[model samples]
Target: MGHADTLLAMGGAFLAAAFFARLGNRIGLPTIPLFTLAGMLLGPHTPGFVLVEDAHDFEMLSALGLVLLLFYLGLEFHLDDLKTGGRRLALAGGSYLLLNVGAGFGFGLALDWGIREALVLAGVLGISSSAIVTKILIDLGRLGRPETRLILGVIVVEDVFLALYLAALQPVIGGAHGVAEVLFQVTKAFAFLLVLAATARYGTRLIGRLIHVRDDELLVISFLGAAVLVAGVSELLGVADAIGAFMVGLILAQTPSAARIRRLVHPLRDAFAAIFFFAFGLAIDPGDFAAVLVPVAVAATLTLLMNVAAGLIVARLYGYGPGPAADIAATLLARGEFALILAAMAATAGLDERLAPFIAGYVLVLAVLGPVAAGRAHLVVRRLTGGRTPDGPDDLAPVEAPERTTSA
Candidate 1:
């Protein structure tokens, strides 16, 4: 496409996303699905008004969206929160992973796909989309709620698990025979995580000094450079780039400039994040959904059940009531970027042909459902629990509805 055409397409995509999101807002729906729906309708895969011939055109911007979303999450997260709830977070995260991943593995095996394909599906079905979760939290204005802290902690644990999971699965999918190669991959991934963790824990002062400046423009440039550079290195070192960006934010969170950085990054994060979801929809071909309908339905149902179970378990551990438990379940129910990543790996490795469509359908289902469920979780909990409200001082009762535009 010519430069003018590219501009027009990009402009049209933004406008369509805004229009759909505005409609969702009027009906009290979440923006994540609406933005995605806009892209799906306009994308080349669907009929009429193709916004872009290739979804790859938005790849870079979408990636930036993911990075910024996680980066802001890390910024909001603090060392003190981890210190106070370390053990609880560990247990909660562990229980969540055990239930979801174990069930997902069994479900994959039940599909009669190959062992390699099952392994891929295990990760795909297990991990929640950090990007979507972050957006929901922000949209619902639930950041101040006590359960939100636990949710973010769980996300951190999942990122760590993902690093090891990918390491173990890579050699299997790549047809590597050497035990040494497997050990090396695991060790390298673990080491990189440790290094970043240690930096977040101990090196804040130096990092703060490096990125600190008098001018907002220069400071923005410095922090953005740091985030993107570390994210690139993390990807090269066999870790997710989002984790790297998150780590950078974590490190900067301890600095004097933390609040300023957050202020500067919010607009960029919102714009890019809208693009991220839109681009995701663009890549999906609606025509393929029929091929994987049954499995997708079953998998999505299983995921909902397991997530709710895990949420109840975590709430019990934290001494929270059904309201918080429902919030936990609904918030973490969506699957996105990670599942797509695994599907791509499966396709590249020539695993089961059905894996891609299955994941695509599954993600699309939950991406819409997850946010809607989260929005109404309190009502669900109230109805189920005989009108007993959330118990904690920081429950969802205090979470005000965010402004309409904030959803994007």
Candidate 2:
């Protein structure tokens, strides 16, 4: 499609999501599921609607959205919680990642897939839905609760892990000859990230003086330019585009105008992000689900169980009583854009050809369950802990648990 036609199409998609987000909210369903279902309708799997026949452009924009989303995530990444929750964040996220990888690898083994496929499944499952979890906490206005704090910290840790793994996944899955070649690629990625982190700390001034995103049109173009450039750079350097986009986000986060930048980028991001979702619906082969509903249902149930359990346990470790902990657990039970994005990454990395369908099915389930999870969390906490109780002022003490990694 030409630029103008593509722009119009994208605009129409965004409006559709916004329209549906409200409609979903009114009808007691989550906004994300509505958009997702709409996307499925537009996909080639269904007849007569085919808004997205190819997904290359859609993935490109979705990657851009995830990078920015994480950048905003980083803006909130204060390391002060490193004392207590930080350690728990690391431990929990790492343990979960390890467990997920092992389980996924085991599944791969059972399925007789390649090592690459195994790792990809583990990576996809190890990661949870940051977007859904955070929104649940925020919407309930409990983001500051000690239990919520712990859960958020763990979620942040997962994001970091996902980012790192995503960066390495492309090379590892690409058949890079041997360990040394893989190590070299990893080192380059490490070096690249270190440089970007350093730049995020100190480089905004130079970019600001040069880029001058003062005008709305200029701002939007520059925003897209940064995403495209960083993604292209990562591609050139044999790193994942997600890594480059994230680095760009981190750098942008440090800018004085980041909040404003995010505001300006939201409409653009939301538009593409919607197309990205629609593209996923389009990408699903009708047959992937036709004969596999039972397995898909079982997989989704397992995912929900594992993710919620992790959330609750982490909340307890952070000193929350059992009630709030369960709420924290239930609150984070859904997966959306980021998780699916990673699944799509697995497709690009050629890890497991089977991953996309599994993950797509997984996302469809989680999207429908997100708000329900939040509601159940609220109910469980009230029933168990007697409602709206906080972990109290004592948690202001040391954050180290000696057992799990925590974050902020």
- Among the numbered candidates, top lDDT falls to 1
Which candidate gets the maximum TM-score versus the true structure? Answer: 2
Reference-based TM-score of each model: 0.81, 0.83
Indicate the TM-score of model 2. Answer: 0.83
Q: Give the TM-score of candidate 1.
A: 0.81
Model 2 segments beyond 4 Å from truth?
Answer: 1-12, 56-85, 92-102, 202-223, 378-408
Deviation from native of the Cα of residue 123 in model 2, angstroms: 2.2
Off by over 4 Å in 1: 114-117, 129-178, 319-324, 336-353, 371-408
The alpha-carbon lDDT assigned to residue 39 of candidate 1 equals 75
lDDT for predicted candidate 1 compared with the true structure: 0.78
The digit string of per-residue lDDT tens for model 2 on 1-408 reads 778867766776677667877887776665555676776666667787566666565765666655555544554443343455555567765655565556656665555567777777666556666666666666666655555555666666776677678777778876688899999987887778778767776777986665565687886677668866877788777777767876776666556666676677665555656656666655777577765566567666666667666655565555555566566556666767666767666666666556677777777787667667766665666666566655435635544322221111
